[model samples]
Target: MSGTAGHGTVKGRDFRLFWFGETVSLLGNGIAVVALPFVAVLTLHAGTFVVGLLTSVAYLPWLLLGLPAGAWVDRLPRRPVMLVSDAVSFVAFVSVPIAACAHVLTIPHLLAAAFICGCASVFFTTAQRAYLPTLLSDAELLSGNARLQGSESTAEVIGPGLAGMLVQAFGAVAGLLANALSFLVSWISLRAIRVTEPPPSPPPEVRRRRLRTEVRDGLRFLFRDRILRTLAVFSAVSNIALTGMSSIEVAFLVRTVGAGEAVVGAVLTLCGLGGVLGVLVSHQVSRRYGSARAVVICLCGAAPFTLLFPLTGPGAGLAFFVVGGVGVGAGVVAANIITDTFRQRYCPPDLIGRVSASAAVISFGAIAVGGLLGGVLGELSGVRETMWMMTGMYTLATVALVCSPIRKLRDFPESDESLRAAEAEKAVP
Candidate 1:
């Protein structure tokens, strides 16, 4: 019931509520991830390009609204922003099943729903990241992030198989309804929290600045910092490849690999298991090898496995996809936990929202691009060929990290002053 601002642990009532709500929400999202594409492909008989476009539409809001949402979230109450976002998402997802039941569902309708959910996700994710630090002390962030990521990964494991069964028994629309309900739970959980968050306190000069000025300040801070900038660029490149491959994964599984709905879900579940494993070991990995080294090790080690994707086929060959996915998923999730904790600790409190948004705009915007590219390539080239290209790009993208200043360091700097001191020391040589 009490506030957890300076607490060294994340076991406070408010945090538990937050975590439970997020875990359920993520489970629903996992279901929707399979449901939406299956609906497009099975119910409507959509082609590869349309399916890819659907994925892109779901992420386009990050490009369209990310900056402004971050700016506004910084000025507003973060919890309320998250609540409103959840409400909006609930409406958007709930509409899908309603339209399907009415027999009025169309591709355009699906696209519209995806766009709306994407917009809500932008604000909700931005605000949630900013709100988390308030619930735990600096030392608690790593453990908290690991727990949250672990829950998310667990949802990924359960949700796909559940979605497959729901689609098989009831219908694809059933999955959407479940997702809609999850948002409602999240809304209730957020509302029940008793902790009173402090109001935003920008410096006098910052307070007078306009929205654009505030956004610019965040971007400047993010880019001016060498480590943050390097990580952002690496994420941007990696996301493009990752999203591109994912955009067409369902199509490839169904068409190229001859996987049924249940099989598709099963494969994704196995991959999610890898993510869970990553979360379990992320702390020890970072502690033993150092966060900086851990990130590089995870990414580079995972990159080569992507080559296995293009080789995936039916029967015994399906093992290739499973193996590749498990490796890549584990590495990406582990690296994300470290980097997310780093950003939360590294950025200042007042500017965390903007900084998070700025980083996301670059990193997540690439997702839209990747989705479109994957679809177009799937249409132009074969799905298998496109997979080859995307996976190859994914492997090559690691070079950005290998060459960055982070490669020279063991652990990441705790603050900008420490970073500057390190840079000065390096310069003297």
Candidate 2:
């Protein structure tokens, strides 16, 4: 049992299959990161505000459906939820190329597609996060998560560059097609997993009252847990700043830095390399320094470099953004891996879906707010100024983590058993 547990993830056929599918899907998402905006700007002749609006619309589902999605995922089978999500995204994305081919594509149609895909993502992502603990034991989670983050970071590193070439060669519509195909591949890979999920614990027979009660319970638990609450707030604030930066980034490159599409893609790709570096280093950092301290150190260390972004310029000066991007990327991913692992281990198995969803509602919902803010700010203050404003906000957002209770701990809770034991002691009356 010890030997099997030690290298479980490495030898687990189901895990490898799941990881491969997610990796492919991540790469497709990377392509869309570049493709979707280009389609709005180039194909639809969208302005900076419209571009930001498009980005905001894509994340709007998190605000609208994030909490409910989490509750629903907890009540249903995770694999089927994921499969359904992929199918929805597949249809929504594939519709774009079909419309484009028939000459009926418009900005509204693209926005509708994005909104639909975003809704699918809320269910898929919440289920997937909850599902990971089922696949790997607590001891295997760090390594498993790191491997997943590494592949996702790699996708970020490669996706944009590929998107650029595809857009340049086959046009923007090709990226959506690529994304659709990727979803089909993900569906097939998930369908092939052989692990039988444990049956969900039965809920009370309250019918309509049960769903609302379960959803509220998730929200209540998240806010009641000090560590989870702090982490959730930190994520929400950081996402706002990050999404604001991203919302106007293409415009910043095109208008302020005088970059073409290919150059923009290449530069963003360079930024993504830092995430790969972060993922590779996270396990070692957590082991040596501990996860709690690692989060603070990573955030504090990465905060200052963001100031470098606003200084970026056309020609050789653009290297400033690359340097800043690398720092932000590495720090962000390291922080993410630590927090994600912590949540998986710390939350109760029954509540994780709701916890993930509730947390996501705050974090991802902030993204929507940030997107709109970025658009309004960009239109008023200009893109470079907005970058400076947004990046500066990110630097300040670390204060939440610095002051949080986690900083007092040596490390996050190690496992479900340890966490449950602590809870039992606290429950003594």
Candidate 3:
């Protein structure tokens, strides 16, 4: 275990396999991010509100299934849960291209596909987060997370550009096929891993508890911790604004900015480029500035740049979107690396799934709300106006972090034990 868990080394075959598969899958997901909305706009001729509704539908499963899925994942073998999720998502996405080929692809069909894929994502994402700690020791977590996030960011760069070419040549629906095949690769890689995951060991009493009780306990654990609670609040608020802007981003570029499909892909690629740069610097920043401080710097510094997004125009004005997106992307990605590493190390292994799900439910639920709100506002006011509102809200959301106890700490507590020890010391005085 120590050999595999060494910092700055990627010697573990199991982790390598896992990383490869996820990187491939992430690339496909990047393609879908552009392709899915383009299909709605170009193929189905959906309006901005309807497109936003589609985005909301994709994330709705997280709000609906997040809590129970967390409890269920805790009770089951996590790898198997992830495998099943991959299978389900593959089937859901693959159907889209088939429907298009048959001239039977409707907006409802697209919605159903998005909803199904979202449901699978709720399970897969929760299980994947919990499973990572099993592969790497606490010392290796930051390195591992940075590697994974770096790959994801890189995929974000390559995938959109590739999707644009594919869409330009084959059609919007073709990108879904690439996504579906990536799922198959992920499934195979997971199947090949030989790591023997220890069975989940809830206390005998916990094993006998009702599922609802287990979920409540998870939520309780998260909210009871001041740092975690603060992080959750910040995530929820940030996601609402970010998702609102992203839900209509494709439409905004195509219709409002007058960017062609190829140009849209190029602009989106800048976001991934920023993410890669953030990943490269995250470890250094955390080491130099303290994890807590790094997070504050990222969020606070990035917030104002989002204002440039709504100011985008045709030729020279596009640079505003580019610079603003790169800033936001770098900030968000670097901050996420620190926070995710903290959660994995700090939370108890048994409660990881549930805690992660609880956190995600709040943030992702906000995403759903953002999507709907963006759509309604886009329809009522305008796409550009909605962008302004969302970006401004994103800038304001940082106040939640500024007001929290996080602002006072230099570094986050390492574990529940560290937090309790600190409290005990305070009480001794």
Cα RMSD (Å) between model 3 and the true structure? 1.2
Which segments of candidate 3 are over 4 A away from where they belong?
1-5
Which sequence of candidate numbers ranks them by lDDT, best first?
3, 1, 2
lDDT of each: 0.90, 0.87, 0.91
* Candidate 1 local lDDT, 168-281, one digit each (tens): 999888999999999999999999988888888777887788999889988999999988999999898889898889899989999888999999999888878879988977
Per-residue alpha-carbon lDDT of candidate 3 for residues 1-429, written as tens digits (9 for 90 to 100): 323556555568898999999999999999999999999999999999988988899899989999999999999999999999999999999999999999999999999999999999999999999998778877788998999999889988888898888899999999999999999999999999998998887789999999999899899999999999999999988998998998998999999999999999988987678888889889898999999999998889889889999999999888888898889889999999999999998998888999999999998888888888888899999999999999888877887688789898889999999989988998995
In model 1, which runs have C-alpha deviations exceeding 4 angstroms? 1-9, 426-429
| Candidate 2 backbone collisions, by pair | none
Each model's backbone clash number: 0, 0, 0
Cα shift from native, residue 341, model 1 (Å): 0.4
Superposition error at 374 for model 2 (Å): 1.0
Candidate 3's C-alpha lDDT? 0.91
Pitting candidate 1 against candidate 3, the one with the higher lDDT is: 3
TM-scores, all models, native as reference: 0.97, 0.95, 0.98
* Lowest summed lDDT window (length 10), candidate 2: 1-10
Which of 1 and 3 is ahead in TM-score?
A: 3
